[model samples]
Target: MTNETMMQYFEWYLPDDGKHWQHLAEDAEHLKAIGITKVWLPPAFKGTSSNDVGYGVYDLFDLGEFEQNGTVRTKYGTKADYLRAIASLKEKDIVPISDIVLNHKANADAKERFAVVKVKPDNRSETISEPYEIEAWTQFNFPGRQDKYSDFKWHWYHFTGVDYDALHDETGIYMILGDNKGWADSENIDQELGNYDYLMYDDIDFRHPEVQEHLKYWADWFLKTSGVGGFRLDAVKHIDKVFMKDFIRYVRENLKEDLYVFGEYWKDSNSDIVQYLEATDLQFDLIDVMLHMNFFEAGEKGSDFDLSTILEDSLMKSHPDFTVTFVDNHDSQRGQALESTVAEWFKPLAYGLILLRQEGTPCIFFGDYYGISGEFAQTGFQDILDKLLYIRKYHVYGPQEDYFDHPDCIGWTCLGDEKHPDGLAVVMTNGEASSKRLNMGELNRNKVFVDYLNNCPQEVVLDEAGWGEFPVQAASISAWVNKETHLSS
Candidate 1:
């Protein structure tokens, strides 16, 4: 399916400590007015404690029912309220997708105990059965380091100021600690790793059969009960590839719907990304890393990266028909935040490429449309969501097999139909204005077209020489349709 044809969803997080069903209901209406077809809500499941960001899992079945203000009456309301929110979104023709965290459980009072080393092992001494150490990103971390926080208290687990040794299970699988060493960077470890945050909690052994069963149970329950259209798999890179393969197959067998599954594989290289997609029958159908890199290069250094060509190449060469494309996501936008803000100008180009391209499913970032300003401004930027949605719904065509490229000049065109010699063509340019003339020997008397971004309609009349000039602007996008092929809708 083309990016324009599929339902575009926004990633939304409801504060665990704030609002109620009424507020969520109101928010659903706001999303509808802006043409969002779906809202990706964070995990509604009950956690070990009131750590506002809901990833710290305690009870998978609780659904936020047994906490302080979680009486089905206070903020975030009840399970019924959650259902109401889902129904409300459906009423507006929008689907509600719940964000699920299946990688690890909360460090605080873990329900399942894997194993803990009484005597620290050598070589892999930093390994722990559970992720007790708090990193800077978690809520329990000190003021500066928010990601790290211990999942449990001191008595239940071992607390060592130094990094915990990596552990090897009896089955010979390596399980790394959840401390700073467990993260991707050493700098993140130095700044956030601390004494009180040393305790490690459970990290599931995916090699075990029981663990697979546990995951399947929740997957079945969620699909049957919550009625979500798809899942945004969190921390997919951390889990074993075999586990993901089986897990995706199990979910597909049970749900039997056109379910979409994407992952948070944070990398830019197409070579690295193609492996993950090949591993599963349903690996992350879409990824956001490449676009995030492109956005960073475009916004930060004002680099002339041809986003359209890059997307086309990624889709055509690597993983076709199963890629998710997006400009910005929750994590990256929050960190390197753009200031001048060309969201409105950028969306038309981004969507034009995503929706018209034939290679992958296109994903529209939430904040890009909603205009999240203020302190959230740096973290959440959705300023041009409406305009993008408008163009996506009206102007762009669905995905097709034939895609034409002008990579040298950082431009490409997607043709919806080619056989009839009459089709909708979307043209995009990056920071360069150039013109191209097509040789249409028998195709004469064609109507000259201008894209939605163009203010005035500029018509090109074909002379007896059978040549016409197509002008594209710098750092902008445009789309054209042969007048004969215009859709009535």
Candidate 2:
């Protein structure tokens, strides 16, 4: 089966809470029951001092093994625990996709090259007599912190409007910065620089050939050791494009299968997404911004959303192969007050729109299925899991046909086959209750059909229109499928 036809297995954070291994195992089982074939987990490596959402990398190999909580090991348990998690998931045929941070390293206790030296306070020497000379550690308020410096001199790039001294020329091995830009621009710049609100130890010289080898080593280790099926490439925009191209190629060649690689190309426009798609193999198969604005925003702002035309136009014109489509993700939420609170009621509409259309591979967010609560109250994850899996199994893999959207009614039809003439049709309304005739003249007369959501059964009357009712709730989704065989009828 094509990747597009497979059901997406997604989890926001596996082992979200440190001691929830049992709970995670149970969640995996639930996902398996619903036909989810793959799972995406947050970073599982060692982070900085604090857990800090698992993005701050102290040692990628250690995998979060810290000597806290009675030497219990990592934040989410030991490497054994992670292996157990993956093994359990594998038993259910669920592929695990791990989130990886390769852009930079942690700043705390930075290796020696990053340490700033104290020249005579007023010395204005343009060039150091010995460029590699290490001066006394009286540079900043903190003294005798030599062990904190990294092995390589680090350079800071301008981020969040903070301008550092630009490198004009190369002096020996390291690039020399004139001076710090200013204090005002540097206030929150440190947080913006690193993965998880820590200063970066050193800006990786991706241009260096060794850096490429180092990245491949990590990739090889991750795939071979952890049994990961794919990767979610973090922070692609900040890294050099050439490096990404080479890195993706190396991974494609080295990794066992046609490994899935989705980069976080957070761009607002389709044009910008197109560039990233052209560069990377399969960057986010969904354009996150458009999904937010089109589905979530449409639901939030009201079913009579004015931006539907803009969304349709943009999606229809873009690169369809790499677009990963979804309603809402971990970062954003878009839906009505009641619909947002109760997400199950909203899936048939959102999923109906996404899976039925042929723009890109559809990704169902974890919250949409498992019914997230507390911090994730808006995401009714489990509420829609069964229904979504059913849709994926029965409808999504079928041959897709015309998708028509009217001012009041939006509908699409998916046929079983050209010769068979059996199929499913979904229609949604954004306005008052009305009965409209769908142009399904090709369907056989007296064929029984079922509305899966409501479990209401009806018969298709060809040439004579099949009647459907719009709910008084302004906007709602309904689906219908033909039950009788064309040959028998």
Candidate 3:
């Protein structure tokens, strides 16, 4: 079976002209041609505004179908366009993963008087102010939607917290005071900042039975309406882990049992991630933020960084089966709130590490593949990524061998299975130009191997015992394949 690769199809700075969905529909064939088996689309629902990047989710039911957010079309496109894009992806056998932001709701339609207690930003568990009435923007009527799909009007009672006090003209973390209203169980949520249940805007209260049922209903409706094969759950660390696991189970049981679900835990420690996995019963995969941090540090530190230890203390090492490895993401891209972009010079090495490995399911960032726009514009690695992606789909296979003896230079090889005979060798260095004499297995003995990346011009003829020294450029990566395949391509 061919390897599965996912591509995050949008950047932080995609043009707000509302044509992204159309572009996706047009590019579905190209994406499949490039070996992308899945596409994680940006939030398809209506947001705070048409220009909102879908994270500021206003109405879950109004997926660019209503005019409540000053426009009928979202930053991507209209409801029709969004559906068409999903169809295109499905037609190409590509799984369309929808970004689901359920942690909070933004841009409420009206203000509702509610009693709340102001809490310290650093420590949400401690209330610094007395319970007082504040007119909070927690009423979401979604008038434009007019309860078309399901009349689920939200009020302040349904939420756990609100950030802005409209009547007092104040903005802070205000925990709503009501029956069963508070942050999610601390034991079930991240302990960061005492409790991290309230991320931003009006935090959703999953503890409420109505809220849980409503969201489950929404999930079913969303799957039916959007035709998405998978879900990229956003801000899961702040939500209740028990609820997340249950919600996924509910969706899969009622809808599709093979539904692909992954959450953006955004934690860097493998221990913290493991805790979440255990809490959620390992129902979904998590993006390897720890691995991304390693790439970021390696990119920033250059030669001083130890290349061999890149996978150390990462989810890839501890829980590779449930890890979605990526070098950079929308949050880690340039200028985003969680910005920690891997350096451009080091991307070749990072891409090689993630895409060529047999460990984790790799995701290619849109900003890295198609380039980022706006003030911090940067060139993309389209050419190199295309080469690496092709090699991953058709070449990478069989028994893997790791050559991480050196701190700055590391190499690995996939000895090739019966189906893919002329397997591949990969060598990379963070320091000077070098060669690593790696054994390519007896099956590949006496074959002439060439750098598929073409970064190095030399070719190596494997000896009778299948040992050949692979040459790589300084601070670069070379994906070596059989000479015959490289020339044919």
Candidate 4:
């Protein structure tokens, strides 16, 4: 089904227990029942430490199998548990997508003496100091695995830089000038800082052939080892654009199975995302960050926000197919790094827009669906989400007609065919209680329509001309589907 409905399964603030994967395995059937076709998991491999949230990548091969970093299992779970979770999800025909972080590697085994150069954080191109000797923790001899997979050892040569220098006892960006190893930073990446290629801890040099082979090996190995449907690439802007394109190509070449790869570029500009798609020849679906920003802005402005401006600079307006629309993610949740929490009151409205719409692939965030852990208990969409999912899975159908006319209220209708007889109508208002006159075509004429969202709390009946007046509450939304339409997928 091409993952029409995607669920980002894990949130960043989840309790640091090595039991998440097991819990996810148990939650598989519920996910299927809730209309989730694809589930995206966080980084499975071992990070800097046992409690590390996986973005601080350590060993790609170690999926909680080794006794490294003070624990045998990752923060998620052991290797066996991770596999069982995927298997459980697969048993219900759900495609499991794993997160891939390739920009940097963290938690090295040993320190090596090397010549280093410091660069400005604002301007990476400008070398702030000359190359000086520093003991950088860049050696990686995977003592736990005992070289089970590829025996290629990582040293200062495989990477271009390190943050902490042991000998010098300084904390800054140090460009590693390995002996006889030329610097490899000539890839077209984010042009924010002239070149924002280097992101964090032990930045992998994409230009190096050996480094390239190792990453390719890991991608293929990961796919083969876990049999994951595809990947959700993390921090693509920090890595070389060419390298990312090649990695996807490599994954496709190795796995003859249909692979769906989408990357998180995380830019607030539609043009930049479109430009990255054009620049790398990488057509993978990107998370619509610009659209999320608009959603966030609308949530902040409340009734004052114009409904017409919602789709102004969104990828769904232009590149619909290649856009993965989401309300919030692990990074965007409250108290996280990209914390732009959508206002709680308007969450149902936001979820209604993404889930019920026909354009773009909608992703239900873990925090939004299941509620954020402990401290942020006030969040989550509650009963409205389950109802919306049912609507998205069953009622939403056919060719759409837009009625983005009013600044206060906007509505659209999906003209259903003979199979799904009475199509759907959606009316959303950012201002005080309003109603919109919309045509549902002759097929639905004189039929009783009810707001599935219950915000309207009123039934609408169409006239002989098929025109109906649908009303919604202030700063809320109303979705009108056929009163007799049965809920089934």
Best by TM-score: 3
TM-score, prediction 2: 0.71
lDDT tens per residue, model 2, 120-142: 21222222333332211111111
Highest lDDT: which candidate?
3
lDDT string for model 3 (58-132, tens) is: 989987888887999999999999999999999999999999999999999898998999999999999999999
Evaluation by TM-score, superior candidate among 3 and 4: 3
The lDDT-based order of candidates, best leading, equals 3, 4, 2, 1
Q: Please tell me which model should have the higher lDDT, number 1 or number 3.
A: 3
- What digit string (tens of lDDT, one per residue) describes model 4 on residues 41-65? 9999899887888899889999999
TM per candidate:
0.69, 0.71, 0.99, 0.96
The parts of candidate 4 lying over 4 Å away from their true place are 1-3, 178-187, 486-489
lDDT of 3: 0.92
Comparing 1 and 2 by TM-score, which wins? 2
As a TM-score, model 1 comes out at: 0.69
lDDT of 1 by residue, 179-199 (tens): 222322221111122211122
- For candidate 2, give the lDDT of residue 218: 66
Better of 1 and 4 by lDDT: 4
- Poorest 10 consecutive residues by lDDT, candidate 4: 178-187
